[model samples]
Target: MVDYIDQHRERFGVEPICRILRRAGIQIAPSSYYAAKTRPPSPRAVADQQRLEMIRRVHVDNYGVYGVRKMHAELNRRGHRIARCTVHRLMRGDGLRGVS
Candidate 1:
């Protein structure tokens, strides 16, 4: 929705787009769009981005053969202190899978 607004905003403006969306049952407000544009990423989001970089580096370095278990152990061995489920979630989200 935000992306849609961004694409058409220059032509239609944020308030008009939001008003149209509200009339169409989407319930989005212009302030909501502005707030979303202005808000900073959360702490967990920052951490996950950092962890994702590390995970990608590890996965590529190990020839992409490390599944979740090995990846979790390897990250722990490197002193990352990340949870296995977090690793699984990130890997899955990024479509980084091991050769099972």
Candidate 2:
């Protein structure tokens, strides 16, 4: 929704786009969008971005055959102490599915 707003905001303006979305039952406030646009990324977002880089490195270092479980284990082996679910989510986001 924010992406849609961004794509059209220059032509229609953020408030107008937000109002249209609200009328369409999406309920997104322009202030929320403005806040999001100005706010710095949260700590978790920074961590996730860092984790994503680490995940890609690990996946390539292991020949890209390591699925979520093995990738989780490998990250732990390298002293990452990250959760299995987080690894899974990151890997899935990057389309980094492992071989069976």
Q: What is the C-alpha lDDT of each candidate?
A: 0.97, 0.90
Enumerate clash totals for all models, in the order shown.
0, 0
On residues 66-97, what C-alpha lDDT tens digit does candidate 2 reach at each position? 99989888889899989999998888888998
The number of the candidate with the highest TM-score is 2
What is candidate 2's TM-score against the reference?
0.93
Off by over 4 Å in 1: none
- lDDT: worst 10-residue window of model 1: 28-37
- The whole-model C-alpha lDDT of candidate 2 against the native structure comes to 0.90
- Which residue pairs collide in model 2, if any? none
- Most accurate candidate by lDDT: 1
